[model samples]
Target: MDHIVIGTAGHVDHGKTTLIKVMTGIETDTTVEEKTRGLSINLGFAYMDLPSGKRAGIVDVPGHEKFIKNMMAGLSGIHLILLVIDAGEGVMPQTKEHIDILQMLGIKKYIIVLTKVNTVDEELVELVVEDIQEQLEGTLLEEAPIYKVDSLSGTGINELISKIDEESQKIERSNSLVSPRMHIDRVFSVKGFGTIVTGTLIEGTLHVNDELIIFPKELRTKIRNIQVHEKNVNEASAGMRVALNLANVHVNDLSRGDTLASSGSVQKTWMIDVKAALLPHAENPINLWDRLRLYIGTREVLCRAVPIGVERLEPGEEAFLQLRLEEEIAAKKGDKYILRSYSPMHVIGGGVILDTLPTKHRRFNEHTIETLKTREKGSTSELIADFMNRKEDLLTSMEETASYLGMPQTEVIEYMGEMVKKNQLIKVHQLYMSSLKYEKLKKDITAILDRYHKSFRLRTGITKEELRSRVASNVKSKDFDKLLQLLADEKVIKNHETISLSEFTVTYNKYQLKDKEDIEQKLKKAGFTPPSELELIGDNKERKELIDSLTGKTIVRLDSETVMFKDYYEEAVQKVINFIKQNGKMTLAEFRDMTGSSRKYSMIILECLDKNKITKRVENFRLLY
Candidate 1:
């Protein structure tokens, strides 16, 4: 069953709270001050059983001119709204402002309930209804049914409830089953329940014994119990007004704007990306980097609006924006937010979050703007896929990705699994990246190595760490490792504790300028001791530099950090291969006996041949592969 929250909005003392009381026999105004003053000062809650047997939560908001902020908080979580206008007075200042705010908040499904109809004549009530029609002409409620009700007389009270049920039944139920995130609109302590927080569970499920994290303060607590409309339940789903009995958090640590969520799932964010359009009838223009008040889910934050691709957001113009907030907020992508001017507190426009965790962007950045537009422009599933594809490395945290995609992580996990089976992408652990990026990285590394081989023909292969440093400009570490592994899988590169090019080779056409016989005699007498390349060059200055360059390239090493020239390695390889062929496989003792060298020299020569893959070292014996 869908958990729907219904809220009332209209001018001050317009019978919003009174109508709720008549419909549900529960006085929403709980405070003595509210009863004495005969006006609601804060939000009130009431619930009723619909004919469909689904329980709907009623949030009664204050209609006074001074309590619009409180009204915004109450209406933020409502799935369907009741715009209660006084029949006698028709639309007043606060009534129009409340209606404009509801439209700006992106409240699409609403019913116009003309309250206090019994206080006015029937003909006058019809005129008031016509006036409401004009007020809602271009908004979401233009076609909404107008119900006349008098809370004092209880007239049309049943009809209002029926209409709420009828409209709520039409809304499609969301299937998200992730960790719960409830924006706390009311925080107080119940005598035995400890600290209880009440609000709409906007996403996921809440259950007893679930560990939760309250954001901004990030206090950890466990849900001792769950309550829906004063009734205890084992589990609570999204769209329901719930009160969570917290085990550890105190009442003073939490407030109205704070959010309670499952630990490790939701992170507090200080910046968000949005795709917003200024209201065409906005009183003032919104300039780039303008400061504004952002109201999202039940939290109001002061934010700097950095417009994307436009310096000044003219009336009716849409653009991507990065909002730098003064306080941390728990917001997801695609969540609607109302943006208001800081001073006048008038709703300038509203927008949907495109990127929850975003870096600051400069104006007129075409690519970033276009990308945000795609997320704002596409359907929910399409946007999710696009966001995952852009991440490139599937290694990004699932929680972060969910926040970036503006959906519950559980929903993303389910859809990601489907996408993976369809060959759209892959998930390793909790991170996701496009399979295309994985393949492209391999091709890029292959191209890089191919270029290095062509340019530096003298070197055997480059070091792996050095390659990573060089490729950092183009590829990230996670992506680089992923590509290297892919290349190794395809046998395009060889991994020897380090990555090496597949076709890399050492050439000595120039190094063999001296006679082979003369070099061998010199190296054999040196006996594990090799002359420096420059010292062996005698008087040729050009030849000295050339041989010196070969010192680091294709050279051989032995124990004690001793180095041998490439010419020596070449000679020793041939000798070792010939010995292996003649004797099938020679032991170290037999090899040393044949070579007429010391144990150290014998071991060094044997190891050099092993390093070059000329022979395999096994205990005391060597074998030719």
Candidate 2:
């Protein structure tokens, strides 16, 4: 069955809650203060059965300007809005505010309800309708049906119900039957039921015995029972006013603005990107870096509003804004938000959440502005994919990515897992590296190696850590190692201990052979006290040519500190082995005595031999193995 949420919006005493009570026979306002004051101060929810056997949830929001925050909480996830106007008062201040807020929130469908018809004459009602018709010009309600109703006398109430029923039949059925979410606008305890929280189910299905997590608090509990429209239901789904009888929670632990979701599905995010607007009657113009109260899906948080593409956003203007919140919030892509000024609070404007978790955006940059604009125009999936593609580093996990994208982690993970199964992307741990990235990494490493050989010929290759640090520092340490291992597995690169290269051995062309011979002759003639690679290649192409030719060859060994010629190294090793054979163990001075070389050279060659598994070096002696 198709389920639709219809919410009422207008000024206080406009009969929003009373109209709902009369239509659905369910009083939404359960608060003592609301009933005593004869005004709703929080969100009140009720549901009615349509003529077509469909069900529609009704959210009766507090219409007083002081409780506008409550109205914002009620408006989220609503498919249809009922903008209630008092026929006797014509158009009031909050009536206009509510209308502007609904427009900014992107409510496309609504039916305007003119209440208190019994208190006014037909001529006055016509004038009120004319004024409303003029005000709703160019808005969502431009052509919507307007109903005149008096809830007190039961006049036009039945007609309003029939209109809602007709509209409910036209509402499209949702395909999503995943885990359920109910943004709690009301929470209280009943005598028999432990802690019952009520709200319109925004998504998924909830049944008895289902585990749920209540957010910002993150409390986990099972559904002891379920009630929809004051009656017991085996299962509740999206667009139903549900009261969940939580198994193990207290009323104090529960509050308004908390969300009930299937366990381990929703995530918290401190940063988000949105496309917000200023309300028409905002007290002040919003400047760059101004702070505002962000009301989204029953949660109100203080967020720093960074105006994108402009230095200031005037009233009634729309712009992309980045909301840097003080606390983490549970929000999904396509969720509507209502923004109010921080001081002398008033509803300014609200828009959709584009990216749930965004890095701080650059101020007023055209490219960044254009990107955010594109994200604003993109679909939920497209925005998610674009967010992933724009990241310089791999997303650490699908869960994190989904949070970053303001999408349900399950939805993104399912789609991403399918893509991986299709070989479009690769996963290492929770990080996703695109197949294109893997291929690019392969090509880049090969190019780096090829360039390295051209620049310094005396080095065998580069260390894995060095290459990783230089090529992409953002790659996670473990994933970098994993990528190197994957490269080795694919034979894209060869790993010799920590040293890695595209090719295992260096090739010897005629030019390289000549260069190697020249360096060898220079080292041998100098009696193994050869010049450093930099010294030989000092500011001259000839020297560079020589070092490049002998890289990775037996002729020159690039050790930790110094370079040793193959012949010199062999002579030194043979002298050490001979001394060890003659003396069983030779002291360092004795080995120095055998090589007749400098202390540094002898020590370096000894360490090189030790590293090569040919000899063991101790405090004062060497042992041939």
Query: Which candidate wins on TM-score?
Result: 1
lDDT of each residue in 1-625, candidate 1, tens digit only: 5578888988888888888878788998898999999999999999888888878899998888777778888985678888888898988988877877787677778888888888889999888888889877887788888888888988988888888888888876653555567788988898976898888887777788988788878888998998888889999887888888899878888899888877655656899888787888788778766889988878888988777787777887787778889988976666788888998777788878777656677667777877777777776556656665555333455565565664666677787777678766655444565666556656767787888777655445566767877654444565556656756777889765445577565455644544333444564567545654544556755443333334444345553344565565676667768888987888877766765666777777788667767789887789985
- Candidate 2 residue lDDT tens string, 380-463: 545545656656675456755654454556778887887788766777776887777677778888888778767655556776
- TM-scores for all predictions: 0.75, 0.69
Query: Model 1 misses residue 502 by how many Å?
Result: 1.9
Candidate 2: lDDT of 458? 50
The lDDT of each candidate is: 0.75, 0.76
TM-score of 1: 0.75
Model 1 ranges with Cα > 4 A deviation: 191-193, 263-267, 379-394, 397-403, 406-431, 435-483, 489-492, 506-625
Which 10 residues in a row give candidate 2 its minimum summed lDDT? 545-554
